[model samples]
Target: MTTENRAGGAPAPAGAAASSAFRQPKAVWAVAFACVISFMGIGLVDPILPSLAGKLQASPSQVELLFTSYLVVTAVAMLVTGWVSSRIGAKHTLIAGLVLIVVFSATAGMSGGIGQIIGFRAGWGLGNALFIATSLAVIVGSASGGFAGAIVLYETALGVGIACGPLLGGLLGNVSWRGPFFGVSVLMLIALVATMILVEPTPRPEHRSSISEPIKALRHRNLSLTSVTGLLYNWGFFTILGYAPFLMDLSPLRLGAVFCGWGVLVAIFAIFGAPWLKARFGTARTLYGNMALMAVVSLVIGVFPDNRTAVIVATITSGIFIGNNNTLVTTAVMSIAPVPRPVASATYGFVRFIGGGLAPYAAGKLVEHYNAHVPFIIGAVTVAAAGVVLSTVHRALDAADQEQAHAGHSAQRADAEATA
Candidate 1:
């Protein structure tokens, strides 16, 4: 449970005995703020989507596309953000993403139609993909050791932003649909300034020859399994969060309370559950177990929809697994390629982004054509497939790791014999 800093051969300070958690790095706080801002945009519409539908003459399908389009763009862009970061560095990416977010957010506020608004949302995603991937690099690069905790904390805090969005949006909905965007834009501007001032530029590693190398490395068990796992969780995670409000419009309690409940579960469990699961089971076991847990809950929701109580419970419980999904994925990618963890993280993000991108769009269409229930069904199937992919990848990676260990021992023995 303890880590030694490779820098000076010293044990890391215990988390419980930390003089302060806030002093790790200025970039840590900046990245945290950036996460808050990115996630705020996600949650900002939950309270108001139905209302926006009414005013914009948008159908449920149309409204959901807002999220779908953004995710698609983000997924596609995430592939290269790490490469771009390698060229320009994390600090530059963070600053640039912030600027684009600010401009696009302002444009979103002024958008005259649903199409324009969706386009603006896509712009935010473009900026956001760069911002998020780079910010992650910044946080990881900041630490001497023990960056995993910080990564989990970042994901957990994002749950808070998602949680707060509906409540804040609900309160502000009466003002205008534009109110949340404008307000979030203001907050983003502050984060941008704070990030620009506080985040020191770090040295960029030389571009690795042939970006294809990272993609090739992903065939290893860890990265491949985690990416599949991430995609599965995201597909289901959005199935619940992105579509729940629309689904809950069918219930008596309405969508606001449902989103609040879902968000709360994600935040609470992400903050508390992630570290416990990772520590107790070890990353691979936790990653494997949670996929099963998620699949069960998602199926339960699909099967028992008439019982609103069961549906709510199933939806919220899923968040517990989601809390750790990103961490598992990020950590696994790191093991796959320790030297260029940023590139590994991006590749994982990109793969999952593809899944997340499709979820909303596919779910929306399914809701329009088949029924609202169809989204969850497909999501459950996707998660099961993810389980298969993860299992295969994990087995493969463990074998490779063991092989490398044996090779290392052989090399050491030969060297010692030669010296003797």
Candidate 2:
């Protein structure tokens, strides 16, 4: 793939005025705002996990189901997102997702039982499935400066949302566990309104993808390798997100603060650090080093679960690697897969989410059966395995990164010549 295609499949013709990636149309900004809110939903509940467990008389395992239901549903639902968006259009698909999130999040806030909240979260997940899968395509299709700029913008939204979600959750969760849920409902409602008003309807693709296309895309080895690497890495990622709270005996506000710090690092690394590293070290080498560091960090968390300061430091530090890894992996998947971009995205989402959906619940079970430390140990091991998995696909990833680097140099040389 060329550097332009690696950016997110949107490319500009040669010598076209390279517009500033930051300067975007009203529609792009609107969708980006919505993307921020949508992603916030992922970490919004972090501060409230302990609160929910205590209030509902549920166990850690039960509370962890909130992630499982949401992610599992989102994973399965990803299979049909391309089909739905193709038929109804991107604007409508986004609207439907926002509506579902608004309703179900509010309903979850009112739930009398953990079971009820879990069920509502599943509904929310279905909506997320549609919105997330289509949002990238919409951004790529609509934005200026080609695919790279759009993707950076998209990743920026993701980073900002993730960073803020915990802070919002913490502040509201201090009042009540339900506060975060209601908060998300209100915020997403606003996002929905902005989207409806600002984003023009997206044109449908000439050939709508089949429902089975994502699954079939997995037949390609590069896509499969990337997917499994993501899955294993996520096993560690969710374990930290879901289980770390139990180890921290701080108030909801304090836990939220800790995670917010983590999120800040994540956003910074994803938007700035990831690209810098990839440009300097190459994608495969960067990933190898970062994944190894993550394994060490997870092991530290596992070994020092009772050391409050150590745990907090490790947790926040983990965000750096997570953020870098997320950007690199997503970009790599988009670039390396031979299938259509939408199909590749859907297929990648479907496969990786399996690890994300299952990991947290498994973390809970491991804690119940073994100990808190044991779960982190497992998390460490799994993340290490992700690095090993990436090694198998090293040739493909390296080639893609090398091409991108060369293309970037060529572009720079051309610009210099033009100025001269």
Top TM-score: which candidate number? 2
Candidate 2 lands at a TM-score of: 0.93
Per-residue lDDT, model 2, residue 324, is 93
Q: In model 1, what lDDT does residue 62 have?
A: 88
User: Candidate 2, residues 118-168: lDDT per residue as tens digits?
Assistant: 999999999889888888877766777655566677888888898999999
Candidate of highest lDDT: 2
Off by over 4 Å in 2: 5-20, 406-420
CA lDDT scores, all candidates in order: 0.68, 0.85
Cα lDDT tens digits, model 1, 1-420, are 122222323333333212232356666776787788778777677777878888999987788877877788887777778667767777887888889889888898899999999999899889888888777766655643444455555675578777777666666665778877787788889999999888887677655324564476466555666777778778987776666666555322245556666777777666666556655565566777888888888788777656678777787678677766655565555544433556666778778877777787677788789876778887888887777777766654354333322322212121122111
Model 2: colliding residue pairs: none
Q: Whole-model lDDT for model 1 versus the true structure?
A: 0.68
